[model samples]
Target: MFNQRSSPDKLMRIGNILITPLLVIMAVVGCTPQPRSVDVTTNPTPTKLVPDMRATTTVIPPTETLTPLPPITLDARVAEIEALMTTYEQMDLFSGAVLVAEGGEIIYEKAIGYANREWSILNTLDTRFRVASLSKQFTKILVLQLVEEGKLSLNGTIDLYLPDYTGPGADQITIDHLLKHRSGIVGEPAVQNLERIERDYYTQEKMLELISGFELLFEPGTQWTYSNFGYYLLGVNIERVSGRTYADLMQERICVPAGLTDTFPEVTSDIIERRASGYWFDAERGFIHDSPLDMSFVFGYGHLISTVRDLYLFDIALREGKLLNSSNTNAIYEAEFRPIGDETCEAYVVEDGPASINGFRASSHSYIREDRFVVIVENVRSGGYYLPGVFEVGRNIAAILYGCPYDQPPPHVGD
Candidate 1:
């Protein structure tokens, strides 16, 4: 049965899955003062426990009159990004692809580093990488589509759809709770012991069985917790109600209609062209192969793979109401602003960006009101040779586009 109230300790456990060790590094390093020039190719490496030199130094005045810089045009913005990316490449902090768009047209697009590092195969705009939790947005859209069609109800309980399932608070957990990650279900259990179980493929039934046996972390709707289990179950509910598999339904409803050729459920065994090989970094071992997992285990939660261009199409489609009506689309954005786990939702949320997994990280910004968007997808992990923080990479690009003050990535010591 669902608990009516949540304990403080339980509420504190709602950690965001998207936050990676790299973000921790950034938090500790903190932000530096923005430089006068945009050239980031020569920024000094960060050092630990540096004394406050700013307090001790005397101010100096220039003899000549300072000239104010000219306003940057759209073409200049593209060139600035290219220069920034070149600096990142030299620093060994970035690899993969980036695409920026405005008013439904691509303004700038570029690819850096190798897709298959072993073969030295260069990454291109077509190089597909796992979008990780960005897949959740797609899943959310599918569920909303069903709601619009009257095939599913947002307030409907899990038991109403999957009566045979016996998860805790099955009757009390509503579709809204699952979509918002307030269902109290735990998801990290499936990720643990990956080394032992990843070799074998898991069917939806097998994954569900594993998730259902676990007790609720908190009562449904009492507290927000990001749960892969919640989304997976929602996927199952979609399957049960629509009488179709998650993949088939996504194809028929979302992908086909949007003309998303590159976006689809990842099938590990099948030969996928232009798929970037995943890589992770270790202090002791340097860049290492990302541990493999059966794609089936990540169904509806994270399995979709795509390129930047395909994702851009998705953004445009959503903005133009190709998938859902204007009312439903607005509702989706409203739901997005409702707090997720411990994090407070942004007041004027304009984008859904940043999805990180083991070896790959993806982020896209659709400034719908501003009529501009940015997409950055990296195939390298942080703490590697020169890889920058994933969130920082996205932030820098956005700053450049908006002509806001921005700091270059602090140099990693080893690099």
Candidate 2:
């Protein structure tokens, strides 16, 4: 059974097959895919892809006559994913970037739509967008690295490292609780509901002061509420314990070693080249300009800005166990994630995880078992709620890649 409430374990639960790691990353996190020849960093660009549209009656455009697929090489299964993208972009459902890799090679990648609509700039492979809670994975790695270095203990309380933190559950909250979001640090009702926060400029000191005043929602480790404040404290703890700035530690520990050039903490004051403008999509009013958030507001929870290529390199490095010792690398997979949905196929099952913030949604879904996966990061999202987001796109993409069943969206109206 796919038990969402079960204790976190090392079990690799696919639709039906539960298996072991590596050799078995062949399944990634779902079903096994027939082996294909590919590996990390191998990108082959084909000038033209004959679209292999499937799912609910696909229509070939009137202008282009369908060439008979070469019998020698049937249309690539990945093309179905491209067809899906065309459908999404036509519907104004997705805009940003996507990269897909399998058997260790990048099979497909593309940048779609406008990066900055005002200037009419197009999104490119190198475009940088705020990654939101995806930053937590780096925080998780840093915390685990500290454990490996004997500088911190997962079971240890936050008070051990940062003595000045006077939050409600400083003594009761374990570092483990914080990492898992089991920390009970509840923000003010207004912050929790995200009212007028986008317009406020928060400095690090002021943000910490705000966190200091937070009260716990429940006893530590007894429940989960996805506390950004808990993660902010972890960042503060990392700085306090390592005596290095978060940016310095990240660049030294993860980016430099992983050969990641474009991944870094966000700085609102600096002009970040190729940074994409985020927008809110309103069906009735069209695209509304997304408000700028203080870098401090994002803080430890979602502060990093990166591109698809850099995100892929980081995934390759981490899964190859280059980022941490074997134990911690495996821990990344085993660590509990707030379950995505009741049925497994409905979610991307990101090895690092999936997240959204304002105008952006990011997912790093890997078939570690099949050595296959999809990475999606986009700008422009509905202001009302989450959904019609990348999670749906990635799930369908994975299904196409693995030959699993998935519904391809029908063509958009009047296109």
Candidate 3:
């Protein structure tokens, strides 16, 4: 029985998934101010990747086939995802980047339309985008690492580390609960003070204070709710146990082993050579160009950025057990489901599945599956509201990749 009301903190805003200009600009400045040494390890393992090229620079003559696979052969699945991009781009509905991977191979990779409309900066396969909630997976891995090291225990109460925290359920909430969104913590009120301050520019200490004071929404471990606050606290726990910053942990454990050069925890302004600019749309504000919200509060939960290629590679690594141990991995996946609805209604399933990675339109935005994963990224800010579309885009791509029918639909991810 999943608990419908077991909402985690809202610290994770939607913008984390897609990098907005606001976030990029703020990330650039925020990272600059905090200077820290990052550890870089060299892994001799080499990957069998197709020659990497910028989609923006590559000229696929209009008459040239749009196949992104080997020997220029087109698979029906790849063709459909390509066609969907064409249709969506024509409708002016989507303009970002996407990649679909199966068995650790790129079945399809593309960047459509404009990354930046003004300078005519085209989107590219290497161009970076904010992966909003996608960052949570990284956060979860860090916490699991701490658990493996014996610095923290999943069942250990939160009070073990932060003796001063007096928030409701502080004594009862465990590290496992926080990771699974079962902590029952009501997440936003702690930030009322920083609400006046811009999220990106705020100091880390202030952000912690905001989270430390939130009240409990339900008894610890009662149900599951997607709470950014729970994740943010997990970040704090990492800092406490590792005696290092969150950014440092990410680079050392995840990025280096995966060989993801374009992905990083902080954002900087002087756009990387192949970075895309994000745009927002509104009724009154037709197209507002902005950076991703600088969320110091939810820094660990959703403050990372990466390109589609790197995102795909990282997902593959995690699924293959390159990151965490088997027990921790199982625990991490198990934390996803929280029982919801009444007896007559079905309990919400929270397992990571193939459906979660499908672009934006799909409903379970945060889910990641075992075999195939699709990442649909968008650039337009107004496009943020179309996250569900991103999921659907992934789903459509998945259908083609797995030889499954998109219209036929598969099992519910949560179920």
How well is each residue in 202-272 modelled by candidate 2, as lDDT tens digits? Answer: 86677777777766789999988877778888888888889999999999999987778999998778898
lDDT for residue 123 in candidate 1, whole number 0-100: 83
The local lDDT score (0 to 100) that residue 297 gets in candidate 3 is 45
| lDDT for each residue of candidate 1 in 165-249, tens digit (9 for 90 to 100) | 6878999999999999999989765467866675579877787777888889898899987788788887788888889888899
The parts of candidate 1 lying over 4 Å away from their true place are 1-70, 189-191, 335-349, 383-386, 412-415
What are the runs in model 3 whose C-alpha is more than 4 Å off? 1-47, 50-74, 188-200, 267-273, 290-292, 333-370, 383-388, 402-415
lDDT of 3 by residue, 1-415 (tens): 2223323331111111111111111111000111212111111222335333111111111232222222322355566666656555544555677766544456666677566678766677776766666777888888888878898898999889766556788889999898888998765543454434443565656655655666677889988776777877787778888899888888999998767888776543344556566666553545666534554644666566677778767755664567887655555444232211111111112323221111111112112332344566676644323222454465455435433333312222232
TM-score, one value per model? 0.78, 0.78, 0.69
Clashing pairs in 1: 92-386, 93-386
lDDT per prediction?
0.67, 0.67, 0.55
Q: Which stretches of candidate 2 lie over 4 Å from their true place?
A: 1-75, 187-195, 335-353, 384-387, 410-415
